[model samples]
Target chain A: MADAEAKERRILVAVDEGEESMYALSWCLKNLICESSKDTLILLYVKPPRVVYTALDGTGYMFSSDIITTMEKYSNDVAGCVIEKAKTLCRDLQNVKVETKVEHGDPRDVICEMTGKLGADMLVMGSHGYGLIKRAFLGSVSNHCAQNASCPVLIVKRPKSTAGSN
Target chain B: MADAEAKERRILVAVDEGEESMYALSWCLKNLICESSKDTLILLYVKPPRVVYTALDGTGYMFSSDIITTMEKYSNDVAGCVIEKAKTLCRDLQNVKVETKVEHGDPRDVICEMTGKLGADMLVMGSHGYGLIKRAFLGSVSNHCAQNASCPVLIVKRPKSTAGSN
Candidate 1:
């Protein structure tokens, strides 16, 4: 745990296995000042639930094991994409310990929860690489974390070349 | 120039005409600890090229007149959104002015470049909302600003639940 404590001031990227997110992750790894000793590049990806019915129903029997397994598979697929991107981001870095994690639930909550749990000093999120609406783009997850988190939060916007892709 | 110098530390929100971003802009007006006495919220939206064409000789050109018109409409829409959001976000708060800007070209470069030009103390952006990815949602713009800005960048991520949405 103390070893984890040592890397507290490092960068933690919330990735979702996309080229734009990867570009942001790469940008962080390349530009951050982490060479003093060593830092952490914690790559996090979450598996959001496709169906809320089972959760709403609140009964274990409502969902079958097959569905859970399929969800887990989907989670792995997403995580695999994130991990691949992270590896590319870390390809040139030295003295950085890269750790990967895949979780099942809400990404904002999971990421915010992991901030302290992972001993992160600050959080970095890319701006509009994802094609959500401008309103939803800034309001959803980023808004929640900004309002609630105790630590500093970074809300990034991707370039027009990227955001303009629509 | 002196007026611009005195205007440093304004809160710059890259407006993209959305409800979520509007919520974020409003939240910044009310909750920011950076002091409303000397602060203003600068809402900016970058308009992308409407048409991209490769000339016969391989020159890429983006035609403008129509794009400019659309950009005006976009700026008006988001400016209205910011003003409306501010009425409540600030309510009866004192000493803060809310301003909006319409721009053409890259959003990331504009934010970073403006940060330099405005001598901004901080830049804020939303994390994830209506972006392309379902689970991983930090926009690339949020990421780039986090890494490249001279000043601090705040990336806001919101919660998905109705109870947590506010």
Candidate 2:
């Protein structure tokens, strides 16, 4: 038998509430981590900072009392849902360690920092398949992670024909 | 004996006249491909279109013939060097097929098109690792490929500590 602990590879995967990220997690589980590799899978979910706005600028408008609480609950629910999805994807793997984390910050910065801090061997992420203009308008998190991460990055995008499978 | 032909995988690698791309080729050889996999490595080098300069007043102040020839020769030399380097790295891998391609166009477009056309299982390339401002000013090939390639794309970057190794 191979020394299971001798070749443990640490893989960090960035997941979110998007189907593409979930597909990426599935791809990583199927292709990257082998049954004998004894790899550790760390799932990271970065929650964007919540911003509440009130029309207090001369309009004399105020938000309802339950608005903030509802927003908080919604964000928490989303984070929990994504984590549960990832957990379900990894449940069948044998001899592989799995962990999940939720952090509040920019996705790009948090992912890069966590990769460095965790000494991960590889960082896996999903591409949302945005066009050039859209990517420019909304800064690309996977692009930033690829350029800035301390470890190698694998950006997985679903094939065109398979887009409907998810 | 294993049936090598039955398990062949097509892997497309984007190479340029940069140390980082060469490092990516090395990393792919060490980490991704194995003799048992019987992978076919497609090395692609995209040459940018040559530019012809003209005076603002529409006057014919074109580059000298010798100067244009010299620039062409330099570009050709760089492309040849990169392909030769990639070939040498794969010289020892048994039962693996190696092919080289040189195309003229934008790097991002050519890579994505080639991957789709060739039905590549995976696309591997290196990151120049530009920071935010620089990436905004000059677009990144790896970033574009990550979002547009038809197959899974791996963007490999040399670690910060190994920056001086090349």
Candidate 3:
């Protein structure tokens, strides 16, 4: 722990096109970033892998190269948009270097790998607050990362306004 | 989020005899507690429920009243010692209100209930870092709290120096 205090900490935050992620980034900025410490905040947006459609696999849907290029472009634009929104949340950060990254892969795998590859001291993400059945069906990204990440993981759960709300 | 910024935050930290928990408290003190914000740090220790042995056609294990009393006293002492150690860790905290609580129940249930009952904005605890088989045998308290606690949960995982180290 003494050594932990002396070195610069790389805090990797996984972001996405969801309000939950933005809320997490905002919470991180407000709570974790110390004014005196040298902290690097890495905002990572993992794009879902592109669909590979073979000629024999499709029933009715056919994709031309132009359409595929358009879809890839849209994915890139979404990643850029999400990163921009996350950056806006960190506008007031002081003594913290903010960096952004966009990677193409499954989020759970990529996030856990990046934490180890980049020597992250901490990983921050948001909980979707899904119900038991929904979480079982969709599989929680934050939960997976919390279990698998090499570094400490901080899960920022957004408070639900009402019991009936998601 | 603006309202959250304006109000004081209640952070509940669960501690035990394990070094993992103390590491979590230290990490929370270093990373989460802001100098300028009004934060209430609640240190909670949960004692396991006393074993109730019924006189049935079972194994030959009996507990005398004196033994039960001594066991209860030991439990009390451990709780006090752990809480005191956690308090010493927070001795240097400024602009933060520190409170201690000792409750009798399972750690997972007691910790989650306390967070909601105390209106905690966040819950901090340590990960045991159990492997799959060990975790199956002994359920993870941090994982349970992370799923059930109403507030955000920050699990501090102590870094293992060697790959073979636990």
Candidate 4:
């Protein structure tokens, strides 16, 4: 009965270097989680795959070892940086389990797939709130996740005045 | 200071004649709202515009009075039924205000526009949880709202077993 009372909820929060995503992290801390709730936050960062420039015949020179090493360093730095930020934001919440994951793929596909794989009760992410014309043409990550995720998706949008302050 | 503390949160919930949406309403009541929170639920029903058959020359045929009346009655019935269902779900929660509005337009456009106009702090709706292929081809209403709404959007998805049970 004590174990059942501690029903741990898995919450997946997609994070990026963008302030909107960080603001979403903050908002989730403030509004969604409460003292009595047993929650686990999975902070996920999806890095775009390395794009290789190819010649017309589809044959491309292999990247030099130095360049490959530098790219790997950059990728590691970014993943570490974003996850650290998310961790700092959740530092105040005692007893909540936090985990970080980094995946390389299209964010839309990765976010939805990870949510199901992690058995996330809810997926939370930030919306950049692109205007209708821009959103229609460019599409958005949050929109795709909302459409595809198996669980509920909560999109947090910071108010306009405080939008970039994060 | 008291007035500021009592600032009511206008939550716009999009409803339809589907069990998925009603399940979303139930989830909202169970998870999002509380008695201490000043809350107003705006139940919106967007009726798809009546289709008219046009001739090759672009001259459209008009519906007879009986047909038009029948269509109007059907629309009204659906709107009333959905709103009533939402209200009944909230019956146990005392001191929460509920208002209903029925509009004629595409749901995507109407829901976003009304959220801005209503100054909604948040918008809550249900996702149909269509698989990737289906959602990719047939765009979803909740996805569009999450992308375009000025405020945050919480999409409540019922658990699989309990989804259609509601």
Q: Output DockQ, candidate 1.
A: 0.11
**Model 1, residue A120: displacement in angstroms?**
0.9
The TM-score between candidate 1 and the true structure equals: 0.46
Which candidate, 2 or 3, has the higher TM-score?
Answer: 2
Highest DockQ: which candidate?
2
DockQ metric for all predictions: 0.11, 0.36, 0.30, 0.31
How would you encode candidate 2's per-residue C-alpha lDDT over B31-119 as one tens digit per residue?
A: 66655555789999877655321222145567778867886888788789878988998888776789999887667788899998998
Please tell me what DockQ candidate 4 reaches. Answer: 0.31
Off by over 4 Å in 3: A1-9, A34-38, A51-70, A129-138, A162-166, B1-8, B34-38, B51-67, B129-138, B162-166
B23-100 per-residue lDDT for model 1 (tens digits) = 555445433423313566676665433221112213455546775676567656755665555445544545556665
- Candidate 4 lDDT over residue span B115-152, tens digit each: 99888877888886222333344368777777788888
Candidate 4: the clashing residue pairs are none
Q: Evaluate all candidate structures by whole-model CA lDDT and list the values in order.
A: 0.56, 0.76, 0.76, 0.73
Candidate 3 residue-pair clash tally = 0
What's the alpha carbon RMSD for model 4?
5.9
Candidate 1 docks at the CAPRI level of: incorrect
The sequence of per-residue lDDT tens digits that candidate 3 reaches over residues B15-58 is: 88877778889888876675556789999988766632122215
Best by TM-score: 2
Measured over all alpha carbons after superposition, the RMSD of each candidate to the real structure, in angstroms, is 14.7, 5.3, 5.1, 5.9
